[model samples]
Target: MTHVQDGGPAYWRVAIVEDHRLQRLRTEELVGRQPGLRVVRSCETLDELMAWMAGGSPQSLPHVVVLDLVVDRGRDADPAVVERLVRSGMRVLVLSAMASVPLVRAMIRAGVTGFVGKRDTEEDIVAALWAVLRRRQWITPELASVMAGDAQRPRLSDQEERALVLYASGLTLDAVAVALGVKRDTVKKYLERVKTKYADVGRPVRTKIDLNREAIRDGLMTASTVENDRR
Candidate 1:
């Protein structure tokens, strides 16, 4: 409960939001034992954490949340939930047993600062947590490889990727706009920006068909998605 007015807290506050009870306690214990970390909140679900976050005092919230994507009986936590927490001003460090590349990618899009596989050693987890607290991008080697796999592809913001995937998947501009809940012009801008990024990477997508092909190559969509469109 020590809060400095000018400088940050003396120690980092850590919250554990893991559905698995044993894992939750273990993580809580580990973080608590750390020299400069405190286990502020340990809960089974993000909803519980959000409920506790109701006080309107920033001090009530932890500095970083160690979250597991899977909850309840094998249910997956939506990336939107992660995004919400991140937007609330807490850094997120995913600590999940499910090392899914797509899930990691989605969480990254949702603004996760780092990730540590459940199978990773305690040292790795501690290191990842500290890195996140320092605003560093910490990712396991395996997860890093997954992200680096497409390093040659030009990066796009979340909006641009959504626009590319949906528009390239055969949706008209109007439909994409409706789906994204943006104006048609906004959607056009997103797609145009996506095209510019691709072009800057030397893989210009001049047409919608070219976009579809690029999307396929980026694994945003499958070839069958565009292939079936022709028929």
Candidate 2:
């Protein structure tokens, strides 16, 4: 499908999920000023978003959600929210400063169609929204380059990389722990750390292998990257 930058006279309903008041309002304003987009609601937390969606009438529900990976510092964004929005027939266009190769990949794998980093220009942001409106996957060129460059170079501990690869390989937490000769919780913690790095960027954390898959796809983390780091 084509990207939604044609300046067409089509209107798309949108919702915003951001904890920062100013950022949320600014984004809402930008969407409001756009020709084919309108903001139905602006949320500052996941609970609020959930409650609104649950209690609000379907007519008020948005057609698209501008979701941020971090709604609250300690609270990780749940994949279930994205799933719920999609299940409810709302398209998600993630807009965040927390763009990471692994995070983007996980979001994409989880069915998000558009991702635009906050570092992107206004044009990039607009193009991204339009892309998602037209049912196309959009990633900022700058972010794409960063992802590509990072994939080719990384700084990670051997054990950490091993943990990531094994987790990505579909091994259960227990299985990974057994194979690594560490406590299950130890393995779990290691994996959680990897997730936290990406989470710090306001993106969902997936399994280590899943993270690696994202890295591999972005040319950031590879099978060899994992293997070489293990030594």
Candidate 3:
């Protein structure tokens, strides 16, 4: 990862994916004006972005991708596509109008490095990109507040927390069980207990994505945590 402290590159390469023509142009212009940022490509769809990556040299890949969660005329960007980008080593900084906790949590679990609300100013968006390039997680204050206000949040046991983090970081249950030196069913029970706790508090965790969000809100997940898991 590049860092400002280490005298990083002269300019960070950027890719943008926004379906709206005017919005795409505006974002491209805004990013171009930044002192240490450059737009390498501005695409209208995830497919176009993927094709660009496949056709370009490794060195031509953008340092960060500024993505719109909803693209293609109100359709959601496929999580699988986002996951592919992240697994390929491109950090994603989401720029979206949706600031709800569930959606933000879903993106994070999909490996997004940062998120900036569309209502935010250009400066805020630029800052988010920088944060992602530096291998940090960033979120709008409003979104942070919403996550913090989980009134029905449940406290987790140590084992349950471990299970949540491993599974939420994109690990399979069997892999998580191996990592914890426990049986697969034991790992499942741990996660089930976690879900039950949330349900008891009136916060339902019906899916792995929901569990990921809860883990994040409870501080069990972070950029460093995920990086450590990768290592």
Highest lDDT scorer: 1
- The ten-residue window of minimal lDDT in model 3 covers 1-10
> In each prediction, how many residue pairs overlap at the backbone (N, C-alpha, C within less than 3 A)?
0, 6, 0
TM-score of 3: 0.67
Model 2 over residues 52-106: C-alpha lDDT tens digits? 8888887777888888886555464566567566655677888887644565545
Q: Judged by lDDT relative to the true structure, which candidate is superior, 1 or 3? A: 1
Which of the predicted structures, 1 or 2, would earn the higher lDDT when compared with the native?
A: 1
Q: For candidate 3, lDDT tens digit of each residue in 1-231? A: 233433778678899999988999999999888777889999888788888888899878898899887765655677668867777778899898864456565566566758888899888888888888897878787766665565666655445766787898778999988766699999999999989999999889988888877777666566565666677
What candidate 1 gets wrong by more than 4 Å, as runs, is 1-7, 72-74, 148-231
Clash pairs, candidate 3, are none
Ranking by lDDT: 1, 3, 2
**Candidates' C-alpha lDDT:** 0.79, 0.68, 0.78
| TM-scores of the models, in the order given | 0.67, 0.59, 0.67
Number of backbone clashes in candidate 1: 0
